[model samples]
Target: MACGEIITEPLMVAAIDLGTTFSSYAFATRGEFKDDPTKISSYAWCTGSQPGLSLKTPTCILFDKVQNFFAFGAEAEDKYTELAQGGGPHTLVLL
Candidate 1:
């Protein structure tokens, strides 16, 4: 492997999208892709304020006062909201 070089090996492929308002991840095995390129699999996120399932979750990160990672995605949104309502100490980063 070298800079700007492409690898042609057959391996599982995964991707993550961190958007301004949302984030998501998906993956597919090489065989699965060979069968159908559109058959990638992704997780469904559940939010307290939203109905049904969401393929993407809010792009947020929660950290404690010490700056240690605590939660991410929908969990981060929920926890940060809870802390805000209760006036608890926490750090929230929205990407």
Candidate 2:
């Protein structure tokens, strides 16, 4: 680091998977060049769930064409379940 250099705060960021019918995130951050006893930069920068854990989170969002908003995650799943239980005219479509 340069003398009197302003060290910016570290942060985590990610982009979601928009086309796979699910949400996803990708990210990056500065890497350490020297080994230090304490203070290591965050290894995983962007991911849906948590990076480096073999897990990823999807960024899929579902909407009601008529309602014009969104019913996300388990909420969307529950809506499907409700339609099933009542044997309504609901159908599943991927966007």
Candidate 3:
């Protein structure tokens, strides 16, 4: 071990699944994965029109006419719904 040597820490890793109708993310620390590879976490997303959470979110995206990103998942659904009902200006990409 040299006194001038630098120490570096292991970085966390993440996995993302982009499905045709859904999307999800999972992550785990390097040490945690080494100890137990199955130790990963994912978030439960909210489906705007639904009453409960979902394992993953819908693959819907929203943006303004000027190309400004708006939302994703259920939020995008809600925003699109709002635009459709209220006649607002926005673009929705649904899959």
Clashes of each: 0, 10, 0
lDDT of 2 by residue, 1-95 (tens): 78998767544334454545444345544333223324333322233223333223333445665655465543455555666789767655313
Instruction: Give lDDT tens digits, candidate 1, residues 15-91.
Output: 99989888899999998988998899999889746677889988888777677788888888777777778886546
Error of 1 at 57 (Å): 0.5
Candidate with more favorable, higher lDDT: 1 or 3: 1
Cα shift from native, residue 70, model 1 (Å): 0.5
Q: Which residue ranges in model 3 land beyond 4 Å of their true spot?
A: 1-10, 87-95
TM-score-wise, the better of 2 and 3 is 3
Candidate 1 accuracy as lDDT = 0.81
Report the error of model 1 at residue 44, Å: 0.6
Q: Can you tell me which runs of candidate 1 are displaced by over 4 Å?
A: 1-7, 88-95
lDDT of 3 by residue, 3-88 (tens): 97764654687789999888999899988988998898789898688899987998877877666787888998887787788877
Give per-residue lDDT, candidate 1, residue 72: 85
User: Over all chains combined, what TM-score does candidate 3 have?
Assistant: 0.74
- TM-score, each model? 0.75, 0.35, 0.74
Q: In order, what lDDT does every prediction score?
A: 0.81, 0.46, 0.80
